[model samples]
Target: MNRMTKTALVVATLFSASSFAGYEVQLDESSKLTFGGYFKVDLRNVNGDQAYRDYWIGTSTYAPDTNQTSLQAKESRFNVKFTHGAVTGFLEYDFYGGGGNALVSNSYTPRMRHAYIAYKNWKVGQTWSTFMPLASIADALDFGGAHVGQVFIRQTQIRYTNGGLELALENPANATDANQSIPDAVARYTYKGDFGQVAVAVLARTFDNNGVAGNADGTQFAYSLSGKVFTFGKDDFRFTYNAGAAGRYISPGHNPGDKVNTDGSGDLLTTQAYTVAYRHFWSEDWRSSIYYGHADVEDFNGLNADSDRNHYAINLIKQLNKQLSVGVELGNYDADISATNSANSDYIQLSAKYVL
Candidate 1:
């Protein structure tokens, strides 16, 4: 590469559309901006005792002989990032805000997914929780892929990171009780090597009852260990193990951090969950993933709430190009209301996504 050729390339890039191919714009020497996200359309169908159109955990009324199908683009999202020196800001949104008539126009409202700013080792605002191992989540067409036992959440927080260590003080509203004077605290450490990556995170928080019924406040603690291990070629194994009071972190409507007893004392429920997934590549453009997740809560079963939850899914995805792909997934969700009662639903999803 000679100086003349290098200069020509630079000049061409500055004036050609390729310079902004990745939605990148260099405003100045010290500042740059980029925008990226994906647009996706999903065709889904469910069969069995559940009437829901999505992959939901927990118990529902057992409506036998029911089947439903839906098509939507709610998973489409957009994100923008700006970096100036040591400071960077990012904002993201998806169409899951839940406004629209499905039968009329299928219109939906955009909802915030992530809004945050990072300066050096500090991050502030809303984003994926430090407890979640985003890399270990399964690949599936459903929005909640292998979510039954997964620690999945996004909230406002102030976080600090050094190397693989992350510490955060997150919003406490997601606790079992709404009234609280303290934030949820989390600490995590991650390790990455040639084989794969692993992370361990712990969360501690206090839940308070605002004297509504004279209930006492309580403290809860939880932990998660997750990892992705590379196997042969592009194949890998992903897993997550969690213990203690998962509460809303595992997925709302299913697990509660604590329950108030007749004595007005909070009784923290012990819970455990695990998820395992494997991804195998058949060819350069073809891949398949299979995952299973299970969750159990001790002695906290309600008539309509599940004491146990399980999810199983398998998907085959084909990459059409650098920015386009399609996939199909089959999954099942089981929620146990009690020893003898349970709801089971099976779903199939087909999706196409375009990245930008």
Candidate 2:
């Protein structure tokens, strides 16, 4: 074996031996520490439109049948977790090919997606918020296109989770004020039964000027509800669904294009999103899933725009062995814009992962 492999094996052996030795390591019957990770790389061929849009200008749209493209290292992630007594800690990072024209220029920065510590049922650090419960969907590959209700924000927060309920006092990273006046509050409740699990949550935060003068301050609230149905049979299957709504009311004078602003004007902008997915396991070694997602944004006149977006994806997973697996996904995005032609894009991805 290579030097690194040998060293790792030796360390693992020592750790296992130490656990069996007559030493009090404070082993908990209900909690334990574990390490896990996944790595993914994608080769993409862009067609029929751009992958994402630049709202600042109407131009810069990618056209149909672009050159052969490859998005390497699309979604590679590593995570570690520690749990002892009633305390728990976790850290997870992702290295992915970001979407946009600045792809090559954007250096791979280990995105700190989650880092948090919890005592008893209270948690503190940067992690997913309670408001995100309603926006999640089941997909074979998480690295593919926007998963409709998926929220990818990590912020500093103090949270409490008990039974199936959670509450948090969070400072969303999207907040722009230096004084941190806008505090985001979130709550979630989840219930699991023999058949499935159900979750609901709410997120509320104040909006400050994007560190600019004359921005009016306001509050934004989002609500989400989600559920999953698990079936056990010759072939295991799971169905997941989620729906969410978010609205913001901004006062005049503030930069409408702030990080937290969904609309250009300080006026109120409301959005609703929903997702549904189904996964069927043909055997212990093979599985596949298909999903659909939609999002609608209200316009300045309080009317839902015709410019909604829809996403569809299909994914397949294969377990190579006990510790390795492979996955592939196909995704498409469709958007409607006024005056300008509607946009659509399709992508394909493949990934291989090892678990420890």
- Highest-scoring model, TM-score: 1
lDDT of 2 by residue, 57-104 (tens): 111244655444665563667777877767788998886425334545
TM-score against truth, every candidate: 0.88, 0.73
Predicted structure 2, TM vs. truth: 0.73
lDDT leader: 1
User: What residue runs in model 2 are displaced by over 4 Å at the alpha carbon?
Assistant: 1-33, 52-64, 97-107, 134-136, 142-146, 173-180, 208-217, 232-267, 300-306, 337-339
TM-score of 1: 0.88
Q: Give one digit per residue, the lDDT tens place, for model 1 in 1-356.
A: 45576566555555775422346766567876677888898999889876665556543567777788988889889898989999999999998898779678878999999999999999999999998889998887888677778888889999999999999999877454566689989999999999999999999878667667744367778899999999999999999998886567764466543453344566456678889999999999999999999988766664334378888999999999888899999888877766577888898999999888
Candidate 1 residue runs with Cα over 4 Å from true position:
1-21, 58-61, 210-216, 256-265, 302-306, 338-340
**lDDT of each structure?**
0.81, 0.57
**Count of clashing residue pairs in every prediction:** 0, 1
